[model samples]
Each structure stands twice: as structure tokens, then as C-alpha cells.
Target: MFGDLMGMMGKLKETQAKVEETKKRLDTVLIDEKSNDGLLKITLTANREIKSIEVDDSLLEDKEQLEDYLILTLNKAIEKATNVHESEIAAVAKDGMPNIPGMDMFK
Candidate 1:
């Protein structure tokens, strides 16, 4: 029983290490999205941290258009980032857990 407990603790530690590594990798993962024929571009990390935004000079004169494009582009970037983040977390979870029927549904 003691040996089994120690083995489980070792596995838990390994999983924790993998989770930390995944988090660091997520910080470096970038998702870029554009809107309005590429008039607006936004870059975000897999963690949904906004990294940069690029807007065409032509939209500078139109605040409403700029706002609309910015909103659309930002949403797209966030959505993409969210999908990537979820997939990465799911990968980690699947790696740490035992294989079971319908296990993926939890993710």
C-alpha cells in the first residue's frame, strides 16, 4: 500500500511538471486574426493575452469603422486562442488520466 501511494505521488508530480511546461508554451503560442479584408489585425497568445494590433491607415479617419473592425478582429483572435488553450489543456489531461470510454466528453 505504501509503495502504491508513493507511485501515485510520483505520477502526480510528473503531471504537475507537464502542466507548468504547457503553461509556458502557451505564453509563446500566438494566434493572429484579421477583419475587414485585413484592415485590422490582432495577435494574441494562447492564454488570451493581447500581444499586438495593426490597423490600416485608411481606417484612421473613420472611428466607427475602426471600432467595428477592432471588435470583430479581437473576438476572432480570442476565439482562436480559446480553442488552442482548451486543446492544450485537454492534451495534458488525457496524458495524465487513464483511458476510459467517453472520457473526452469531459473536456
Candidate 2:
């Protein structure tokens, strides 16, 4: 029983190490998704917070169209950011063992 407990503790430590590494790597990754016409662009961190935005000078003249495109571009960038962040996190999560019963806590 003691040996098994020691092994589980070791696995927990390994899992903690992996989680820290993932967090560090995620902080440095930048995902930039833009619109087709270059009218709008969004920059996001790996955690999917909007870091910056850019709008073209031409779009400033058209109120209605610019409003529509702004919404579209913002939505698209957000969607892409979510997908990219999820995939990156999933890659890390999948490599580690599932947090289920009878399974290794870290792989």
C-alpha cells in the first residue's frame, strides 16, 4: 500500500509539472485572425483575450457597411481564437492521462 501511494504521489507531481509547462507555453502564443478585405483584424493571446484590433481607413467612411463588417470580423476572429486555443490545450491534455478511475493520472 505504501509503495502504491508513493507511485501515485510521483504521478501527481509529474502532472503538475506538465500543467505548468502548458501554462507557460500558452502565455507566449499569439493568434491573429483577420477579415478577407483587410478591413479588420484581431489579435488574441492563447487564452483568447483580445489583445488588439485594427480597422482600415477606407472603412471609416461607410457607416452601415463598416458596422456590419466589424461585427462579422469580430465574430470570426473570436471563433478562430476559441478553436485554436482549444486545440492547443487539448493537445496537451490528451497527452496526459485521463482523470478517470483506474487510469494512470499521467501518461
Q: How many backbone clashes does candidate 1 have?
A: 0
Name model 2 segments beyond 4 Å from true. Answer: 98-107
Q: What does the lDDT read for residue 31 in candidate 1?
A: 95
Worst 10 residues of 2 by lDDT: 97-106
Instruction: Write down the TM-score of every candidate.
Output: 0.83, 0.69
The numbered model that scores best in lDDT is 1
lDDT of 2 by residue, 38-75 (tens): 77888877767788888898888999988888688778
lDDT of 2: 0.74
- The predictions' CA RMSDs to the true structure, in order, are 2.7, 3.4
Highest-scoring model, TM-score: 1
lDDT of each: 0.85, 0.74
